[model samples]
Target chain A: MAREGNVVNLVENFKTSIVMPTAQSFPAKTVPVMESDAVATSKRPIIRIDGVTKTYRNGTNALEKIDLDINAGEFVSLVGPSGCGKSTLLRLIAGLGTASAGEIDWPTSTYDAKGHPMPDLGFVFQEPTLMPWRTVFDNVYLPLKLGGVKRKDAHDRVTEALEMTGLARFAAAYPRQLSGGMKMRVSIARALVKRPKILLMDEPFAALDEITRTKLNNDLLHLWEQQGWTVVFVTHSIYESVYLSSRIVVMTGRPGRLSDDIEIDAAYPRNEAFRTSSDYGEYCTRVSAALHSASAAGDGEH
Target chain B: MSVIATEPRRLRLLPLHFMRSETAGRWLHAVVPITFVLFLVVVWEIAVRELGVSKVILPAPSVIGEALAQNWPVLLRSLAITFSVMIEAFLLAVLSGIGMSVIFARFRILEMAVFPLAVILQVTPMIAIAPLLLIWVGLDHVDRALLILATVVAFFPILSNTTLGLRSVDHNLRDLFLLNRATSWQRLVELELPSSLPYILGGMKISGGLALIGSVVAEFVAGSGSATGLAWRIVEAANDLDTPRMFAALFLLSGLGVFNFAALTALQHLLLRTWHESAIRTER
Candidate 1:
């Protein structure tokens, strides 16, 4: 029931449930219907990008007429060459910059009970970006403190996020004392403390060694499964995208446009066994072919 | 009974062993400099006595010490006056310098418009204008004239250092703060001020010495009839050819400068030991 993505049908059902007085009269009939409706609403696409284009001040066309939909609970990866605008598109989605042509809509703006617009999304940049002066716990407490949550109330959530990132012991340690992988974990814990519905990561593990990268990749997948939040990741690594994403969007070179959109039919909780399987190899080959053709097309345009 | 007796004896020797190994190097580092100064003073005392130098020409260290003890009441009163003037001037310079730097951080136009004027004030010699200040404020209010002169000499370093510090915020951290939608007031208090603390303290170390020097120079210009600062005492002793008294006053002045520098260093260490690289003492 939580896998349903049609919000229109859910709204219609919600209207009928409100109109029919007998629906509430029977407690048995109302419970399942209401639960399904809530699941459907949660599963709907939270953001829609329609015909968006971005051109910088120096007349470089970074992205041209890009359109995409990001639904809740789906893990999406944007993969492309170096000059492609995957990072630019992520910044646009983050509202850090505006698109030149079209509109990007947040269809479902989640609000708290107090009617304050909760920051329902978190962003991780290429670097860990932790303040060197603060400890891991204080860095994780920043977003909540900015939102006016008292320190006493924010303590539990901060501890939970640190534990999820496997950094519970390092909460009091400064960022300078941490290794690259540990600093990145502190960044992840900072993002997760807000309990955001969507997590946007931009090459978060690009600076780590291959062994550490693989370990963090597995840890991130486990956290995503346990939390059941939507993830939109940006990376240039073909193997990483194939291993982590449920759906991959390959983009064109320089003036980046959508080139290919492929889906992997693999099962969830993918571990080392699946990584060595024939099916994973096949998916990787297919995506590599798509990337090759996309780059070739980009060469022809110039 | 034997175990308890040996335990107390062993514990008493623990500090001696620890100092011999771990803290011995630090103690040596301090002792070497003091030992060198004492050696130099002994050489001077011997040279003066053996060469049969006139007492009026160059007083030995013992004679200077004796002079300091004999005129303790008058010298102490004069030292108090000079020390008070230095403190007042330093406080005024710090408050106004930090207040102006904040203004400059908030408004680029004001900084551009008035920064050159600050540079001009700094480059112009305080000694050249001390007489002018005395005339304007009058001889009766010599302390106030000295205050203005010292403040002028001590204000520039803090303004420049703090301005650089405020602009030195990490680019990535600034972007993160903006992404979180922090208010300007929050940015200044939480980010800018703490980031600028080491720089401000560094500037204070320099200005601390300059304030004392300015007080002494201004007192020289104020002259000796009514002013009772150490500088005036040096001038009166020079005229009377009392070389020992002159050396005594100079000793106190140098001691005050060293004390000021040591105090500021301690403050910097106390505040920045947790995070600043300069203050942290790594084993390696």
Candidate 2:
């Protein structure tokens, strides 16, 4: 009876706090526009990458003259061939590395009272990268713990994230005990627990089997629909970019630069039907053509 | 529905089967070696008796048992003395070694300056230095000389192991901590220390046995009436041609080594049993 009572209470609280507000705020027709059109409009840019260039100390031109404007609540994908520096670009946007030449500006800064930038961005690495020593709960609890959120206060958010990621049954499981897919779920939960305004995922589902990847892609879209955070997903897979992104930024290889920005005008709640539909295949083909040319252009330069 | 009904029953029986196997395995693990050792001892006793071996050359187990029984008080005192020295040196070595490792991890320049010296100390024979330590500290404080010698012997493994462990943290994990803006202290305590635990425990197992050896060897080098360790007893027995007493003291020394190793191993298991791959028992 006590367990049932707790479940009911959690559901009620979660509905009131998370579900109801997100449902109201996110209507069915608020699809994000392309960068070229978005720049002309009055929607405030979340991040502006202005002429950003990164040349490493080892004389490798990782990324060059990359300029992009990311609008709020957009699911943007950076899709390119290997060695295109897409991951490098994502790392720069996350402030993990500094761009050599240009600047990354967050027009609306999310800083705490102490003037320290409160971490408002979550990064999901290619690997799950969960702390093997910590339990799923503790691993998810890490960001909040680092940000000085007390355990008593962090418990609800962590539980909600776990539930969202479908890992509620495995809160006590260590990463080593988990399957590869489950470990990645724990990683996603850890990233989402912070309720960050922007989620930067670097090929998060790249390592999983196709079935698991599809399942996770669907789950991710559901969460994105529920919680409208800006997502910047980096991947080498054309189908993945076409399936997930509202706008796919195709990048060229070595000395990586933006080659094309293609917008997918498909409606929200893209599902298995969409995957099987002619529309999905058309988008994938278009993006694949763009990627093919991008790689071809890269080869000409070398 | 029937399959679901059978699943819970199978799950319930699973742990029961596992427990029975575990208990039987533990019994076999303990009993088999002890029975073999008893068999060997019995054969040894019979061979010595049947061969009419001179007691002065090689005493039988019964005669050594008699010597242990007769000189229980004296032998026990000496055993206590040896253990105390060994334990004190071991504790000191562990503390200083770990402490120095932390310091070295923090300061690269300091590690570069002193790590070679540590290696030099480790490779040099403690037996060669024990007599010098006795003279430097003076024969009046022979215990201190033995303690110093044993600590030197035990220190290097823990230091090297802990240092390697501290440096061996996963590069991606370090990047994660850095991205989170964790302080150096937080990184060391939460990440580096935990990752290093298995290595430190491995070093402790080696150092435990070495500590005992160092103390006994020091006692042999000290070679004084005031040095009342089991090793000293062996020396005294040898000079007086008490072969049975010498064998009894040697037996006690070997037992001490075994006990020390077992205790440290149990400690390693207790500390690492929850998560570490080394401590977890795999079936295959």
Candidate 3:
């Protein structure tokens, strides 16, 4: 339900950062200090993008002539060194930033040439961008509030979102009070509250210690399975890219472009066993080589 | 039980971060000056009789005290009247200042257009403007309120600080609201206003003192001469050379200033107690 079966975006000449602030600044993934439900990801592309390109201001060709499709229920991670237009592609799909000259048409039971993706998107920022003044519950409920959902109906959904992220106990807490991983949970909960068909995430867990990051990766796949929403996750870490993603879209540096799309041949509800498997190590090695080749290609572009 | 030791105090410090506060100790130490007043009063009594200085030159502390006690009701009545004027002036400054700040925060063109005007109002001398306002608005209740000593001292801080607070919100948080598709009005109410609370409260705190001072200044000029606020009492005490009575009135005025400062501080704490750091401190 989640995986889009075909790949599209093959960007070129993206004037991106090898160490753009966005890479480090993306919100660190945090497991809420609560219960954990290990669900797996769905399979199928609910979102489709054909021939999408983004050129940022200042003559930075962030993404060039890219095309990709995402299924309704799948965990797809965009992996790159840095300044690879992976995040840009995610942002374009989220409708946060506009694409320079391509169609981002969504299948809303309608698709015109001029049509863009669904204007209503659930975007989890890299910085756990929770409002400081509101409680975790209020922050999560914010999307519903904007949609004009009454508080009574919004409350239950907000609770469920929190519970899914294992943050129900801390619903009344503020963002500043939470640990790094917990804050990310609230960010995830807020995104989930919208029930968006497509969830765009930008390295949402790069700040955490290794142990916490792996836990969140596992928990995320579980939730992806249960909810069946298309997820576009951006990551710079090779280990994380391999652990959770059904499809790892490897990108290269400066004029960030996608270099490889390696599909994980493993089965659903992938557990601790997958990470230690020999196949996983092989997959990691292949993706590592792909990343270096793309980086070398990017150097050639310069 | 293990206890965390306090960090050793540094000898030299960054001037801005350094605090010379001994709030509790200072309050306790106030006893010295208070008792000094008593000792001085006694010494004055002895010196006056010994030197044979007449009552007209400088009345004895005893004489001033007697006069204040004897005329207590009259001084109390005048204090009440002064307080009444102060309240009216303070309320008007607060209401209009906050109203205008909200306007400027929402409308950029209006801010650009009117902000200079506000700065002008802040720098303009109140004493110079009070007479004109008195003439135009008349000496009636509305006029009295209109010519209130509020513009420079009170209203400006309220306006400037409030505008500063509204503009000080974090960029990412602002983007969050935009992503949520919040309407402009919703952004103002849900995001801008709440974010601006500390600055607004701080402005209100500063403005509170300004408003009180303004009322007294206005009362001094337009206060029907013999029938004004604490200003009139000061004048009446001066006519009779009653220093204690003058001090008593002066005390009430200073007390009003203290009261305004504390009231705003309390209101700030009440509203922001849960979320804000500045409001919950033991000493500000």
Candidate 4:
């Protein structure tokens, strides 16, 4: 199950990536204060969240003084309890909503004359939000179509996306005809169709069963590795965070704030062998403990 | 690997099973309603013939059929007039209703200013307004008056339903569109309109019936001899004490209503059968 050959292939691919700082490897409670890894990656940041704060009109501080930098080609997971505002942070990064204070800068990204980020960005919601009327191919073709690409012009890219998601055969199938997991694949394909450099996913596979979630987690890691996309995934699952992300950011609940930043130093192409290995379990335990303490600390404030 | 291998076979069988039940359901749906209608017609024919009901009061189904056959030319002409009016009113309602709804969706202030006026027209009862419309339109333009009345009656449902449908877009999908930087016009054509289609079609079904009713009500109120609609024929037959001919006209009117409903329903089925839950038939 280790598929040792895949590790060799992924190691060769990894030479192109920057050397990420290995921080707080295990024993979550014994860990010291998080050292800002901004200088460690050395590469230019894809997104810089500088002292960002989000307060709703109703006076809930969804996120407070959040400062982080997501470097290019890194898989970062925002993991915490239910009300942690991980989603709020993701939404801010996506520019779906405005922040109450501070700035989110994409220094490495391009912007158009309108002062809008012009980088190819894809966002996946918790639900597979596909148009029921459209077939899988049509759904994947949407972003390009909105960008004024005709069907004939977009045909190959859409097909390539479907192929990547293993959905090429189901291209003509309507959303209702697909299983939940398959629908989510179509959604992923739709996101990837634009060949986005940044992918912000909010619990994209949380609705799926364990088996499907595991399979998708593998597929997503593979896709990220192959495409070299900067990924910001938000999830409540510690095991999933440990299994998928290069770094896990733990946040506390109810006026969420970042509590800990733990970097996973595991090698690439993690498979069933990695999942079952003692190293994976240790990372999961660390993430789980950090999550527990973060939530407990949040509760103590009340 | 085994699970993957067996999945396609299972997937292939599901549609065949669903389609089989679907065909059976369709067969039952058509046969039962038709059988019940025929049964009622037979009972009506027998009861009228045996009880010796007067032709002037309760014409037998057989006599009504005879009257229909004899007046085919006159009835056909009236049908053509009534049908054209209904269709014209319906098409007008559809275009105006959807157009106004889109406008309302785009500009909320306009919807606020105008929607209540629409509701006022809807709730005030078209029958109460028909006579006034006739007077205002003038006897010289009775045809135009009928079209306006029918259009009013049929317009509201499409406008309201389409508005609700446009508003009912999945919020996540809306965010997705916003993320992709879809323009308002592109959003309307690609996302809003297609998503709202089932609602528009639903409204169309209701409005279709209303259009026919509006035309008949207008003809009744107009009372102008120039208009040769089926409603006019019914009035003329009533005045002459031709109960059989009146029944024949009423029969034609009901037939038209049924046809209108069936055609609209079929159109809805055609458009939404693939995606909409309401249109797709499910197995028990």
Using all chains and alpha carbons, the TM-scores for the candidates as numbered come to 0.83, 0.87, 0.77, 0.89
**Cα distance off (Å), candidate 4, residue A244:** 0.6
DockQ of each: 0.32, 0.35, 0.41, 0.71
Chain A only TM-scores, each candidate in turn: 0.83, 0.84, 0.81, 0.86
Which pairs of residues collide in candidate 1? none
Error of 4 at A298 (Å): 2.7
lDDT per residue (tens digit) for residues A39-76 in model 1 = 66645556667778999999999998877766778888
Give the higher-TM-score candidate: 2 or 3: 2
Model 3 shows how many backbone clashes?
37
Candidate 3 falls in which docking quality class?
acceptable
Tens digits of per-residue lDDT for model 2 on B100-199? 9999999999999999999999998989988788889999999999999999999998999999999998876777787777888878887898889888
In candidate 2, the residue pairs with backbone N, CA or C atoms under 3 Å apart (3 or more residues apart, or in different chains) clash, namely: none
TM-score of 3: 0.77
Off by over 4 Å in 4: A1-42, B1-25
Tens-place lDDT per residue, model 4, B1-284, is 12333434544623444445556667767888999999999999999889999999999889999999999999999999999999999999999999999999999999999999999999998888988887897888899999999999999999999999999999999999999999999999989999999999999999999999999998998896478899999999999999999999999999899999999988998889999899775656
RMSD of candidate 2 to true structure, Å: 11.1
Clashing pairs in model 4?
none
